[model samples]
Target: MVFLLFSAATSFAKTPLQPILPLLEAMPSDLHVTVPYLLSFVMADPLKMAMVSIENNLSPPETLQKLSESLTSLLPLLSQLADIIPRDALLWKLKLLKSGAAYANSRLHAVQAEVLFLASGKDNLLPSGEEADRLFKGLKNCRVRYFKENGHTLLLEDGVNLLSVIKGANMYRRGRQRDFVTDYLPPTLSEFKKTFDEDHKLFHLALSPVMMSTLTNGKIVRGLAGVPDQGPVLFVGYHALMGIELSPLYEEFLREKNTIVRGMAHPMLFGSKYETSRQESSRLDTVSMYGGLPVTPINMYRLFERNQYVLLYPGGAREALHRKVCLMSPYLY
Candidate 1:
């Protein structure tokens, strides 16, 4: 008894629903406003049809059910018209029914369900047993039930039955199953120690002997032997040339200490072309191989966004290429 009507001029008229009416009206001359019109003629009552159209287009599951109920109200009228209508008109209605069945079947197949309710008898809308059967067979775990006594107006003729079927399905049930000891146990000290040792083994395997020796020798030479092994620390150093003189030594020290150091280079160095044996290309690939990345204007903002440790040499290539003896003065620029 709850009537939900729409405004005379609504947005649904400009959308997907617009094509439904025109297509139905164009169905052969024999049909007039018969079976196909049952689906299409809702436009005659524009206010009510517009609301149903909108709900069909954008409503959630519950709202869609309510809209379906409204559409169901017209089934008895459609059934009577089908029985009395001319043969050619009846054929056109059948065409609309087949088309509608295909559309509904496509929608049902998209959902994960164990059972499908299908209408197989005549009414205001088309019967969809064949399409429903195909969809049910394709589903991994689902069965279809065809209501021979029902039509598109199932909710109108027998709302209680529909409600009972929906309740029996229990599709709304959703939650965790149970909790057990496996869910909350922490690793024992011995197990934790074994895991840590395995990780350390893998780390050592990844480093070369040369890299390991340099790291061990550098710590002793630089008076940093007392540093604790609690956790890794970021080490930043200033280099005097394009390739740092201490790079080989630092690399070895890092390997021995089981740590990583990333070096940043100017954008210009990566953008420029370099000559090789076969042809000339950018040096970015070579730079990346040496564990260094070119910092360009495009990615400079992203570096700060990720809170990366950045290295900047304001002097760039110009300072490195100059042969003049330069003083280490901050005001030289």
Candidate 2:
């Protein structure tokens, strides 16, 4: 879904890769041909870049060489994409699109929901401390969990956990002992062992595995010392890098802290909750079992009122596509 948009919009946008004029000239007018053609090219570059990084330890010359090659390769794909949409149209939209909410400040004070501000200290797109502080002050009831060393994608980054912050403290005072722990059932011991062994092997090969160390202000956090041992905590944070950090973040929390974060996902994830399908999909089934509900104000409110821990990335797809450096936010998200 994202790659297709990238292909169509790259010609006019300030993309990392430049357009390939020859490929553009050769492309058919049909989008069907263009999408797969671009996809074919996208598949190889990341692995190639990773291989170069691992082999050369990301030395400047080697890295630049790989980058140049990758960009050169992308020319054909972008050229093919430009056939479907004019570069000028994409450029115009990119320039005019609002990156954030303009009227949020005026409306936020009217919100009665207890706010949990999860701020990333080194966030690039938004100043984490400043934004969190602003929200904290604006809202009638709010508490903050500041990660001094993390960037915008704090949860996705290594060594951070939702459980680490919300384990003990009664963050919100809801009268009933609403135990929605059943909404999040940790994987069985056997299931966990199998998943861990598989993920350990996979991430090592894919990410060039490294030990995770949670730090606060350059000091190591050994246990739940930084977190309040409590219930019904909701974590609000920004999304980054297409929310690529989610799987690792969720996996780590389950593995180390024995907690499952009920991620409030987009409605698309559940495949039309209103409709019933006789044809079962393994992918959708797995996601449903993982406890990803459609995002709604009611869902969030109920979770908090019930004393269940909830994780939210409010930025949606816009934030994920807001790329800057290395498909990541420079110095932040």
Candidate 3:
């Protein structure tokens, strides 16, 4: 809702999204029909962009007809979606709109919008994965969740649940300030079952991983009773074989200590590098579902501020993936 509006006023101020446009500077996208279909209505009465979405107001029939013709030439797709929406034919117009339109990234760094990039792996239309990485690096408050299995229309996909993503990311808030501790929502019943009983079932049973904590007095013992049950606990672990140590680490802690060990994981896992097509998805999903976030100072600060159990692997993936390593050379990149 726009503030400072006069009810009787016929005009509302509007500006092109030139500031928000260059978010992912080189974010590559095809001339998708959705762009034109979207722009078709808004572009029709460019001056009345805000009014387009007002009560009972709609775009002219000719605008939709123009979009239909453009969609028709795309063939079977045109046949299937012609009655609905098209993507390819009008994609170029989006490119032109992006390039030809007045744009500037000067305010990019200052923009404080909380950005969450949900990139689709099968999205041939645009490589949002690449954009996720760029935005994560450029934006001050940004997070990325790359679904390698999803398509361009991520939220619409059966497997891609938007609500779950926001919940898992701890993006929910009550007011202007976000209390990571208060706003944090633990995994629900389905999420718990999916992460433990289903996704990591094999490892949870077959490996039956174990954890032992050291008491302040120096003696080590099984169960979390030895460790402090309070918050702001830090557990630094050596990288294990293919991150196999993660399941037990997260599971054992939650089961024994009733605490979730938030892993400050390599950005590659949460960013765009970890590909399920090559590596197994179970391990990957575990990292995300069970308090695992991209390694960033902000993430570290948030976990600690929430007084949650923090897990960090100094070796990261390098230690797990490196070969012909010597014990003396502890650090692997």
Highest lDDT scorer: 3
Q: What would the TM-scores of all predictions be?
A: 0.24, 0.35, 0.45
Error of model 2, residue 250, in angstroms: 1.4
lDDT of model 1 at position 43: 24
Error of 3 at 79 (Å): 28
Give the C-alpha miss distance for residue 7 in model 2, angstroms.
40
TM-score of 3: 0.45
- What's each prediction's clash count? 5, 10, 4
Residue 267 CA displacement from its true place in model 3, Å: 1.8
lDDT of the structure predicted as candidate 3? 0.54
lDDT of 1 by residue, 1-333 (tens): 111111101112223344455555566755654653555442233224324333223449866676676667655655566457764665576466556645654564465544434334332233244434444455443433344544444443432133233222221122341111112122233322322344233643554223211244354334334443433233444446644433343334343544323345554343212212112112233233223445455444444454433344555544554535554433234
Which candidate should be chosen as best, given TM-score against the real structure? 3
- Give the true-structure RMSD of model 1: 25.6
Considering lDDT, which of the candidate structures 1 and 2 is the better prediction for this target?
2
The Cα local distance difference test for each model comes to 0.39, 0.48, 0.54
Model 1 lDDT, residue 119, Cα: 37
